[model samples]
Target: MILLDLFHYWVFIAILMMGFYTVIAKQNLIKKLLGLSLFQSAVFLLFIGIAKVDGGTTPILHPSISTEIFSNPLPQVLILTAIVVGISTSALGLAIVVRIKEAYGSIEEDQIQSKDESA
Candidate 1:
């Protein structure tokens, strides 16, 4: 019963772990970047989840609405900034991977390492 109340947190943990595992286990540079994006998405989910409040409304000042509980807008604002940053970062990472592929002739980590060692 208690676990059901915190389902979002569980989902966040699962996604975070999956992303981390992919980052650690995948040998392809593209896969690693995808994993990083997933990791970033999980973090975004966490922040959004934390910002939610039960019986809370948007932080707007109205004359009639007597509700005192209000969800924090700061986290949502920060998450928006983070989302833009994350997209920029992913684009940069993909650009780097493309360059790596062109230079190394392969995107796999092991192959790149072996080639580097031989050269």
Candidate 2:
């Protein structure tokens, strides 16, 4: 069972890496940023999935619950923070793209470079 779970995690990580590769390999700035965001979200999902334990409850401090049977909240908290950071990074990236498009009149990074060269 643990091996199966580990396999699932590795599959997700592979997918995430593929997304990263697409981001790096693509010339369109918008497409690259989209791929990057997808990669980051995948990572966040991985973290959340790993934190879940079978038959576990949310990490809540309750009077009846004992320490041995509760789920951990640290990973969730970490993921949440990562989500916010990702959002901010994506927003900043979009803003930069907008500025680049405004200046270059194109969103394709290579095309922009080519046009600049001819000008």
Candidate 3:
């Protein structure tokens, strides 16, 4: 079971690494945004995954329970906030990208750099 749990984490780690690579290697602005989104998702996955317990309940009061193992809700709330922020940021980034595409006629980083340098 422990090995399985570790394996699950490896999947999230792989996703994170892939996103990092995409952001570093890709020259297109849209691709970079996608990479950033992927990275954020991986982070969310890891955080929520770690917050889970083998036998945990929600952080609510129970009258008859002798031994209560309630999960922490702070991470969940924080992650929810992060997700909302991430979405808003992503939308803003894509809007910027669209404007960039309209102004520059290209969304590639190298192309934009060259255009700016020539101007």
On TM-score, the candidate that comes out on top is 1
Better of 1 and 2 by lDDT: 1
True-vs-predicted CA distance for residue 11, candidate 3, Å: 2.1
Candidate 2: tens digits of C-alpha lDDT, residues 11-109 = 778879988997989999988998989899889878888888878887788887775666678889999999999999999999999999999999998
Among the numbered candidates, top lDDT falls to 1
Per-residue CA lDDT of model 3 for 1-119, tens digit only, reads 88785976998999999999999999999999999999998988888887877788877787866557877777888899999998998999999999999999999999999999999
True lDDT of residue 79, candidate 2: 92
Cα displacement (Å) at residue 2, model 3: 5.5
The 0-to-1 C-alpha lDDT of every candidate, in the order given, reads 0.94, 0.87, 0.90
Expressed as tens digits, the lDDT of each residue in 1-119 for candidate 1 is 99999999999999999999989999998999899999999999999999989899988899877899999889999999999999999999999999998999999999999999999
- Badly placed stretches (over 4 Å) of model 3 are 1-3, 62-67
Worst 10 residues of 3 by lDDT: 64-73
TM-score (C-alpha, index-matched) for candidate 3 = 0.85
Better of 1 and 3 by TM-score: 1
